[model samples]
Each structure stands twice: as structure tokens, then as C-alpha cells.
Target: RKQLLAREMGLEPPATVELQESDKEIDPLQVSVLSVSSFIAQMRTVVGDGEATESARAQAARQLVRLAEAGVPGADPEQWWATQTVAEERPLNNKPRLSPSRIEALLKCPLNAMLKDTADNNSDKYHLVRGNLAHAYMEALGRGADEELARRETVEAFEKIQTSPTWKRAQERDEFEQLLVRTNQWIQETRGVLELVDVEVRVDVESEPGVRITGYMDRLERAVGEGGEEGGLRVIDLKTGSSKPSDEETSAHPQLMAYQLVLAHGELQQEGGLTKVVSSSQGEERDGATLVYPGTDTKKIGTADQARKGDEELAEFAALLPPLLDELAGPRVTARISPECDRCPLKPICPVQAEGKVTTDVNA
Candidate 1:
């Protein structure tokens, strides 16, 4: 800096003054001045090291205590939290109405499923906000609101929340416009088959005598096949996340199957389930479900995954839920470690994985 200043002033930099470039490698063993905190921390490390002698560790421990007694910055007793007795975790006793999403979570990890509502879910709220707002906007559009009206109405609703993470109203509004464009383009290019009828429709049905299933369907659409032949009602599930489910997963998606179960069994028979929602019902069964993905990629506005619906398949999937939920609701919930474990935020308090997974084990 001195040399640079001298050169800037047009005086030749002194030959004795030299500054090492920032890119130069630093010597690891080079001694440097230590702050009181750093020195105390080093002493602590020495005290804790297994290789350190008993006498040396004892001396270091004494020094730490002495520092704590003194008004030292590092060795404060108040820093250590008082440990409390942890409550014993038990499985849920009462049966929960298995929502489509909840079923999916339980299928992955019942422990996760059980704790999500209670735990401090550190999942990305930004994406969640965007997803919710997008849904509202899409719903508004589906219900015959114009583009601008939908965007405005969505923002007005979002702004009503008293507490939320910081994402500007203007930014959300702009993104709503982008979502509107992408979803429209996506519908034209990929999701042209199903026409949107209902948005955010709830399906609550006691499929079995004891067990119940429920979820909010993103949209209920009538499938328009070749020659404009109106097919059965198709469940339209919108996914606003960065990653969409694989083709295979989408085909056998439990959530869609669950929704279709309600559809197939005529649980949603009120208000003319098929005829009222769409004029041309033809009294046909649910054809299938479509999972729409509005891509982050602008050039490709549309991406989708389809799940075929059959009464037998839907029935079979529905049958599996009661036993699974019953097992999960009990004390013996199994933690099925899968790819999602890598992204799960509950690891620190997770009953199974709180002590950390084997870092070196290939199978783990």
C-alpha cells in the first residue's frame, strides 16, 4: 500500500518497501500475535486433546478456571447453556386425516411426517411463498379473472399476512407476472389436454370406516382428447418447485392416486361432482392426473408428468394408507433413509439421525 501510494504520487517507490501479493501462499507454521480469546481457545483445545499429558491438561484446565474467575473475554461460564432433560418422543395415538402431501411425507419418513407441524421447519420459505402466490394467481385466472386482476388480487391477499420472511411486495408482484406468462405458455404447449374447472377444491372422504383421507386439489380439469372428445375428469396438480418428480414417480404418485380415489368412489358427489363442475361429464371415470411444471427455463415454458388412473389401482393405493398411517401413528415408526435425508433439516433433533450418519460408510 505504501509503495502503491508512492507510485501514485509520481515519486519512485522505495526499494526497501515491498508488499507481498494477496495470491502468495501463507506459511502454516508461522507464529502470529494472538488475541486473548484465541489464546484461551488454544489452551482449551490442548486441555481436550487426548495426546496431551494429564499434568499439562490439568494445568490448562486450572488456567481456564483462573481466566473465568478474572474478567476475561473468552472463559465465561454464562456461555454454557444449562442442559435440560429431553422429553421422550412417542408415536401419535390418534389417527390424522392423511392429506395427499402428508401421505407422501409418511411414505418417505414417518418421523418427519409426525414432526413437521410441530418442528421449526427450516425449509425455504421464499419458494413456499412464491408457490402459494402462484397457486392463488392461477386459481384466480382459472375462475375467470383477467391477468392483471389476478396478479393484483394475489398480492392483496399475500400482503394480509402479519408475519413472514422478507420478500418485497413489488418483487412478488413481478414474479406473479412471470408465473402467469410461464403457466399460460405451459398450458398452451404441454397442458392443453386438460381444461381447468376447479381450483383449490378440498377432498375429504372416509375411504375406510376408521381411516380418512383429505387434500386440496390444485385444479380439476376435463381432459380433451383427439377430435375434442371430452374425457373423464383429470386431477391437475401444479408443482412450482425447482425440481419436478420423475416420470415413474409421477405415474405412481400417492397424492394423485389418493385424490383419484375420492373422485372414483364418488365421494365428491355434492354439487354435481362431474356434471356441475363441467357441463359435459358423460358420466365417465377419472382419466388420470397431470403434474405441471412451469420451467425456470424460459425457452421451454412447459413440462409435465402424467399418472394414469384406474379404480383398482386407486383402491389398492388407498388400502395401503390405513395400515401405514396406523403404524406411523404408533411408537414403532421406521426411518426409511433415502435421498431426501440429504436435504432434511430436522437432522439435529431427528430421533434416528441426531447423532450423525456414518460419514465413511458406502451404504450409509
Candidate 2:
């Protein structure tokens, strides 16, 4: 009976199938910025079988262009001249060395880095130019830039940009007055906080050959006293935007981590520099900025008052910066998916998504 059963089982032996990974390596090619579809297809091919995978990948590639076009809907031929005029240019290193936003942009997408770094300097849109003038005006008030000139320049710049020439509103005069009032309020508040007065000022400073980092510090206080080293300097950065994040999202924000890393290096190497990012966004209506230090079980709020005290707290915070920076530079044993990916320019080429995996007719 046992022999009969064994023979019966052997009669329907499971089929043995062999799978081999092709040793043939794909050649590395520079992906074209224009050919995002091709980039998606190439990514799928890297991790798939040659046949069915190719067809799936091609379909995926076509979907990307369709999605992108749908998002913008359409382009105008009249604006073609402006678009071509601002064609991508060479990378600029003038990134605010202390701001996490700038660092995060570089890390999240180097292509964005390439785009920003090489941006066409000539495309001076009215709003961008106006905002820049306003920011500079504010910074000048902070830096004590020629007082009369700063005030006059700011007022002149604001008037031209307060509202579009094509726009007419019944409340335009009232709104414009309110803006001037607010600007004056900010200037008055700034005057009180700037005590170092005239000390060769700098922002986004760097020490050569040691480490490469950039940020936009609000001020670099250079006065020496009981709290100051002969070469000691204080770095403070301004935040015009909100600082809150959901509990989970706050933990991995690269901007704050990168800022801490740059400052920490200076602290560790005795470069006499200590940095603090001050959240200056303060108004009943405005959501103030907050600094979420890496690995810290606590969060720091940056009200206008907190920003005022930033210079005083530099020494105390320096002790905490080094360890925090180490956490940032540490090996990543886990991969995290950032939700910010949805709007990321490279979403089409993301390796994890396997987005464009349709088989293609190379002959077609």
C-alpha cells in the first residue's frame, strides 16, 4: 500500500522552474529634463523582466505626460517669449546658507537645485521683484542700512507694487495705508532689537575647506563681552512663515536639521560661530514660526519676543547643536516616504513608485 501511494504522488511531481537574473548591465545615461517620460520608462526597466515589464512601463510613461499636461491644462503661445527668455541657467551658490528650506530643496530634488541654481536672473516678475525689494528694505532696517535711503526706498518700492496697475478697488487706498502702517510697526520693533549696531555684518557666511553648508541668518551678532568669545559670533535667522507641523511630520523636517548641522560644525571645530533660527512671524492673524530641534522631545515657539531673545540665548543653545547635527549626518538605516513627494517635480522618475512600467514597441 505504501509503495502504491508513493508512486502516485511521484506521478504528479511539481514542475521545477528556474529563474535567472540577467547579468547584462544597463548603461548609465543622463536623463533629459524634457524627456521625463523616457526617464520613467528607464527606471522601470532597471528592476523588471524585459518583456511584460517593457509594455507596462511604456504605458506608465505616457500617463506621466498626460497627468502633467492635465495639471497645467494648457500653455499660451504669447507667453512663449517670456518662457524662452528665462530658460534655465547655471547654478548659483548664493543659497541662504542657514535656512533649512533651502537645504531641504537641495536634498529633496537635486534637479530643483539645478533649476534654482541656474535660474535665469533676467526674469524679473513684478511680484518677485517687489517682494525682494520689500525683504531687502526690511533687512536694511535690521542692518541699519542708510536710514533715510532705506525708508524712502521701501516706501517707493511698496507704492509701485502695493496693487497691480490693472487692478482697481474701492478699498485700495485703505489697504495701502494699512500696509504702510504695518511696515512702520515692523521697523520700530526692529530698531529696538538691534543693539550690536555697527559690526561688519554678514549673512550666509562660510569657512572654506572645512564643511559646505548654507543658511539665511537674520543677523550675526559680533559684540564681545562676558558672553562673547574674541572670535565668537551669533547667527540668527528670520522666519516669515508659520512653524507648526503635525507631530509625525515635524520629526523629519530636513530644514531645521540642516541648519543645526551647519552651526554645530562651527561649534565643534571652534570656529567661534553659533547659530539660532528665530521665528519672527508674529501677529494675531499670523501663525508664527517654530523650530523643531531634531531628537528633542520638546518644541520651541518663535514669537516676536522669542526672536528678540535669540541673540541672548546663543551661548546656551550652542551646547545642544553638535549632538543634533550628528543625528542629521548619521547613516540612514531606514527609508522614509515624505508626503511632500506628491508635488515633487521628480515624482515621475521616483525609483520606488515604478510609475511607468508598460511594455513599448521599440519599432513604433
* lDDT score at residue 93, model 2, on the 0-100 scale: 36
TM-score of each: 0.62, 0.39
Cα RMSD (Å) per model?
12.6, 17.2
Clash number by candidate, in order? 0, 28
Q: Write the per-residue lDDT of candidate 2 for residues 180-270, one digit (tens) a residue.
A: 3455354354333333322212223232232344445444433244443332333333333334455444334454444333343343221
Report the lDDT of model 1 for residue 301.
Answer: 53
Per TM-score, the best of the predicted structures is: 1
lDDT of 1: 0.65
